[model samples]
Target: SNLVYDWVKAAILFGVVNTVACLDHLDPPQPPKCITALYVFAETHFDRGINDWLCKYVYDHVGGEHSAVIPELAATVATFAITTLWLGPCDIVYLWSFLNCFGLNFELWVQKLAEWGPLARIEASLSVQMSRRVRALFGALNFWAIIMYNLVSLNSLEFTELVARRLLLTGFPQTTLAVLFVTYCGVQLVKERERTLALEEEQRQDKEKLE
Candidate 1:
């Protein structure tokens, strides 16, 4: 995957750096702490590298931000496709690159949408619960989209079989939603715990300064 998706290398680099930082005092890997290591190494692939650089510097200006959504999506996807072709062609490298671009750009598109002045007034038309529910559902959908992106890059399965698997998985939307809801709850709990820990640490530092 590091060879196929440049982002993987960035994540492994991130993990190794953190591992080394904690090497001095952390407990030894018992039961291998395999799950923790996997969590650290698996998720750090948000890096964009040169592919998205071209998107920002080259294609994004072709129509400016004011362009129609479809054309804009095409131009952005094409930027990565062409970049992959420029690098080299093996088997549907451009296709994965297009998928990769789509995955990356979805976040950007949402950010742009949020920044749109009219979106505030439009969001006002919806109830808070409705908006939150819709956003949470979209989060689950996006998670599946990302699963497809990762599966494509893994390049282990035939394209047709991968499509079949995705079709099979879609039948379990409820399962995905349940998993996402549980994950969200855990994340919120962890975030709150971290916030409290950080506040306590800051207070300790202040007390030390006063002493």
Candidate 2:
């Protein structure tokens, strides 16, 4: 699992660097093509890696003790993967901005770590505290910076025109599929949350009776 995570991270970082480098040397059409390919590659590997890890975790831990949440969690992860896979290159800025603003990726990682045994729980606790401090220190400033940068770049006539052409040429179907998947996943997530809360409450009431 660690090996897979490390390799995926390395691939994404490398892809980002290569894409930027290509922009400097490649011609207009060639660079976009190259970037599109890299984007597909990164998103594919990233989603698969995450899914694999989650499955492994479920099999190891949740499969025995918390089986009830498996379907919901799997659906949520699947939705996330599908949405990311279909997002056009133009959507990367928005994705990055959202992640920066909420630190969703970081929070997810910490949550997973907390599910692990004792040592990982310690790490997860520390991570939560550190994340809170980091957010307190820089979250607002970083969020605004990301928002402004993306807004400026996306608002440009050239960029907007490029995105429009890309969408017309290749992004429409992918975007539509992503929206449908997200809607389905959102419903699943809500149902899962309610179910989990009810189960927790039931367990609490039973414990009170026992006491």
Candidate 3:
């Protein structure tokens, strides 16, 4: 509905302003209390109810046989969500910038995903053997695009450019090292996959010879 769209738009604007302001504090886990506040605000004014998405995408995914993966996935989802609302447009400009900002963290977290749970280990091991086509399919970058849009879209509003310029002065330079480290983490994940596949093939052929 158009109303829904308008609400989303409003929520995005509010989120961007909030995020830029919070950059100075930058607390770990972003303080659950803060997130809760945003959730309430979005729900009340913007109609972006957390319950719907939380139930559909997040609820069923956590706390059970697959519980171990929950922490990592939840963290990733939170980071993704915050960036989406804060960045403001779900566009490419913010997407790349956000990635560069947290790419290293993402790379490490992705690696952590490979080890975080029984399911995670199985998935990572399978990924190592899976075809590049399958990998590409799973690598859908829309999540990233949304975050960028959120960030850049906010720039359309008053004072956004002023805030971004300030962020650039401090956040950008510091994040450079993080970016390089994350890039290295990505390479490590690739190498780890290759090693697993090579080992898997060796064992398969050995079994075949014996049988």
Candidate 4:
């Protein structure tokens, strides 16, 4: 069914599955047949409905090199709103559209922030270990902001109540700082992994030359 809950679940599962599949692929290098088939298998077209195609088209072509026609961010969100309207004017549809639009923009925001000059300067002044820790700290702050932004779409009506309790009953600020200190570890790990792979490729080439 076209339930918002189902959409949220699918989005979460998509993240977990893609992360696991990517990490595992680096080691054993086996076909993640299960992942390949299930990445919204062709069967999923029935439910997923290729609804995102228009937004994608705008992102790719319309929002292309000549962006005066439509700014990229506005183009994506507008097309998505159009898609939601096409689906119908249900409350859940509107909520779903808002949440997904946030997700889309949140993705771009993160990328933009990563490329921002200040972040680069911060990293430059620090040791490699500290620089990565700083990035992850920033990443962790982003994670919570993201969770709060999408909480309604991901949960039941009680999401409002849940937010209330989180704010009222707990040391929310402290917990947030703790989460930041926990490290946004993913980026550092992926960077090191890629560096290792490159080194391995170089070693293989050297061996071939020696032979």
Candidate with maximal lDDT? 1
Clashing pairs in 4: 136-184
Q: How many clashes (backbone N, Cα, C below 3 Å) per candidate?
A: 0, 0, 12, 1
> Which of 3 and 4 is ahead in lDDT?
4
lDDT of 3 by residue, 55-76 (tens): 3465334422323444545544
Model 1 global lDDT (CA atoms, 0 to 1): 0.55
TM-score of each: 0.50, 0.20, 0.24, 0.50
Q: Rank the candidates by lDDT, best first.
A: 1, 4, 3, 2
Worst 10 contiguous positions by lDDT, candidate 4: 35-44
Worst 10 residues of 2 by lDDT: 33-42
Model 3, which residues run further than 4 Å from truth? 1-46, 58-71, 74-90, 93-149, 156-162, 167-211
User: Model 3: how far is 129 from its true place, Å?
Assistant: 50
Off by over 4 Å in 4: 1-55, 65-70, 99-103, 106-120, 167-169, 179-211
Clashes of 4: 1
Output the TM-score of candidate 3: 0.24
